[model samples]
Target chain A: MAAAAERRPVWMRAMIYGFVATWFILAAFPFIWTVWGSFKVELDFFSIADWTYALTGERTKAEYGSAFTDAGYRGAWIQEEFYRNFFNTAIVCFFVVCTSLTIGTLGGYALSRSSYNYTFWLLITALIFRAMPPVTLVAGYLLPFFQWNLWGHLATTIIVLVAINQPFTLWMLHSFFKKIPQELDESAKVDGCTQFQAFRHVIIPVMWPGVITTGLFSFLLAYNDFVVTSMLLEEKNRTMVPQIAAFLGTTYTEGNVMFAVAAVVSATVPLFILVMFFQRQIVSGLTAGAVKG
Target chain B: MKHRTFFWFFLPTAIAMLLFIAAPIVSVLIQSVFAPHEAVLIEVENCTPLVGCTTETMIDQEATRDLREAQPLGRFVGLDIYLDRAHLAIEEVGQIWSTSETWGSFWSRIFNLPFYRAMSFTLTYTFVVTPALIVLGLMIALAVNSLHRHLKGLMIFFSLLPMIVTPIIGSLILFWMVDSRGVLGSALVSLAGDPNFSLKASTGLTWVMLIIYGIWSSAPFAFVVFYAGLQTLPRDTLEAAQIDGATRWQQVRYVIIPHLTPLVTFVALIQLMDNFRVLEPIIGFNASAHATSLSWIILNDLGGETRQLSSASANSVLTLIGVAILLSPVLVRTWQDFKRKT
Candidate 1:
């Protein structure tokens, strides 16, 4: 009877494991497929079965040469307009990340070391900014950016992207900064440190995790951004995602393999690197920064 | 708490923010009314007591010449665009209300059936997806919370991997998996005895796939939030429920539900905000798949040569208004809930 009872619980545990495993499979299957698909040759991918098969097979020399070499480069260059678009997106993300992170960290520090009302106001303001949709200003505001040359510059796109993403970065780092005790700031100030000095030396060291989390998010956002990038970037200055779309049109018949290859390479790799690098802080960062931001 | 210290601490951020973040947003608001032709202008004065002062504004005379150059050089149209768009919007409403067309007619063809249809569909998608995410997230949290320590950490990380993966990649995976010969399709056909398991074409199947894909991609983050909230929950109340002879359902209903409400509200509110901005899945899926989202509409409107900047902007502004309408209540309620907690 005792053995039978024990078997029931063990069986239940196995069922739970199975259920959880299924969920993970559903969540993870695409990433796994994309990684493999990235490496697949043009012909093999056309009628590819079980997306994961791309992972196990070696790419033919021609396929390998095309994906990495000038053949692939020339094909993608004309087909997708990728060479130009990649730079557009990289420039946008670079400036957006740098501007937003700098502003957010400074603002986050103020909110942390400051009074309750400041924190409250900052939180509310950031929340409102967080909730504010990009589509809202797309016409009434951003239209002028395209209409006027000043607003059409690469700088304008960066400025807008930075503004749009700042609230979340600020909110994320604010919460993280708040978690650090005030005692450290007080002692640093007591050690003849100016407020900026204390912030630069002591607070920054302790808040590296928070800074990293915010930076990673800012980077991902700028990297993965589509709407504003699509809207603001002109024909000459199309971004990476748009470049990928342009690839689809250019490579309509035989280009799927190239697109699949580029799509796999450009879209998935940075994200994988991000998760791998910030594996520990990423979960907390996203939950705290992104969802809440 | 000293006023001086507050000023000093807040001033740097306030200044930087005012210049960068706040200035641009304010400028947007200002331009929403003023509709400025130029972004900013700088004037240089080299006074030689003789005759010399020159002003250079960053205005691109060449670009503005075609549109509104007839007006005073530096003057704005002053809400003419807003008023025009508003009129256009009302006409759009009247047409949609009165039309018998499958997609609704637009008073101005610019605000046609497809536009409104896409808007409604996007809203419905958000409405459906957000609550499902909240409830499913809570379930995952409860399940994860029930796990032993080491297993719990591993499980959380596993769940989170999806959240870490880009949504574009996530959608692509779904695209492949539901392709007729993919593993998921084969599994479905074998189980249900229907060989033609079409995830792309059929509406019911498409929605099911979208929701499942959305939940799968998003629930990890939600789970983390709910799990964090669960950790912070006071234990004594749950223990007391057990002591009072509460059944499992009763303990959860009476105790856990109340405690979890704030997290639920936060999750739902954030989901409401983010999901409306969703552009990736539709973009990745492409139009051949019959996926029409509001973001896609805005993207397409601005993407082409007809280049209807005003209409596209109006469309985005409308989406913003819609989001504000749906979300402000949630924000206020969440704020109140948080205040109560503090």
Candidate 2:
């Protein structure tokens, strides 16, 4: 009995350490896999542990240089294609996030300050729109686009993306704006500041963190969205996801590995940036959104 | 000055929403019913009609004739579609309900066997997945709530990872993991020494896969909310209960659970609404074959080769109705809770 009691504390401590280590491993696997796979050459991707173990076993620097320089090779062509996909993703995400914030923030503010009878209804409608299944209306939009000669247009794609994301951005901003306290607005008015001026100078600064958090969320959503982009874009203008899907769906020997690498590269960048830049805001904002009251 | 100021400040937002969001939704509702009425199929006889009019009308048979073509699709024929389908019954005498159509093929889907089945499956899916998420999420929140401060941040971040990743990317990862020769499959073999356990074996496995996958994606979200609520919960209430000689179970039953009723209801409402409308995982799992949920069924019906626009509208209307019916009570309760809090 005495011997068992002496060992219990040490055993419990070891168990806790094991549990913590396992939790960390499980959580970080996707991020680590993505980064490692992104840097790995195609052939080594799916060999699993072998790929990591044999990192220095059979490589030549001359071949690596030639692989980049070879003008006629299909592999080199695909490498260039990825560069284009990455650029497209960046441009689309940039515009979508900026536009949604500008429009959604204005809309959220109006809904917040207004005494309109349907403001709550409008907010609810917006939430429903955001939550509406994307697949339901995507095909409907495609039919119109095809008939109207608007197929393959970036504007159409952006509109659909904006529509999908606007509700949430508006919702988040609404919650944030609501939290600024009415007393702040009242005090500003007493100080001879016009409502607009008070909003610009006072409320906007107080809510800047919330805006950034909402912006990050919107940016990540637009960057990572595959369905609307895939449905809207043709092969020539395909985005990052469809591009990766093409490689992943390929039948070549090196296809799986290359795909894993590409997938890792494309999805991980924004996620890492988010984690690094707005860790606290993202966490707390999500928490607030979750617990409604 | 205050009244005038409020009006001026609110005008831009109100106008923008009225134009963009309010306008589009109204248009969608209109398109669902009346907008489609503009298309009508017109059939015309050509110059020197061959069968019936050739003998009587064609002395100058060289006369050219014109015929107006009907609209190719999407014509609204009214409530004829809804009523005719509601009147259909089982084919007991091998009549197969043929040639008795009051409206058309599109109208018949209201009583269509597949439609009801899909609705049932959707309800079942929503029912199963929502509770699973709430339970798993609450457990995670409770577990994490018990953690020390330094470890709490790390765990919270980990919990939030799934929500941060794109659904498409996460689905793809899940796809790869569940592949027969992939990481998940291999892990099962290593742990249980069974190589034949594959998710692709049946429709049930597909359902299982989707449910678990959803739980994975959503549990983190629930956890974060509940955790935040847990953190802000009044400590004195629980302390008082403990001081009164309440057991752990009694303290939790009387103090913690009741205190968390608002959060619980809020999470439940959100999860229910969200899960009811989930489309991605089902689509990824192949919504057409095997098991079909309401969203997937509606999507398929929308995209079917017949180009049945009215049927699609009807299906969506049914979905919207179903959602309203299912969510109304919870929504009312939440509204009441919000009222109390405010």
Report the Cα RMSD per candidate: 9.4, 7.3
Clashing pairs in 2: B42-B70
Write one digit per residue (lDDT tens) for candidate 2, span A3-91.
Answer: 42243466554654565555456556655554443444443334343334223322212346422222212342364456677777777
Interface RMSD per candidate (angstroms): 4.7, 5.3
> TM-scores across all candidates?
0.77, 0.76
Task: Show where candidate 1 strays beyond 4 Å.
Answer: A1-11, A41-95, A116-119, A140-155, A187-193, A234-239, A287-293, B1-67, B70-112, B146-154, B180-198, B202-205, B233-247, B287-291, B334-342
- Candidate 2 segments exceeding 4 Å error: A1-26, A30-77, A115-118, A143-151, A242-257, A290-292, B1-73, B79-121, B189-197, B283-288, B297-312, B334-342
- Docking quality tier of candidate 2? acceptable
Measured with DockQ on alpha carbons, how good is candidate 2?
0.27
lDDT of each: 0.64, 0.62
Each model's fraction of native contacts: 0.36, 0.22
Query: Could you tell me the lDDT of residue A162 within candidate 1?
Result: 74
Candidate 1 lDDT tens digits, A1-293: 12422434666657656766676666666666655554555544433344333444434444554332333444555665566776776787778777777777877777777766557866777677677666545543454454466455678777777777867877888788878998898898898988878888988788877788788888887877666666666668777765665555556576454554455456656676666667667767756743333
What DockQ does each listed candidate score?
0.28, 0.27
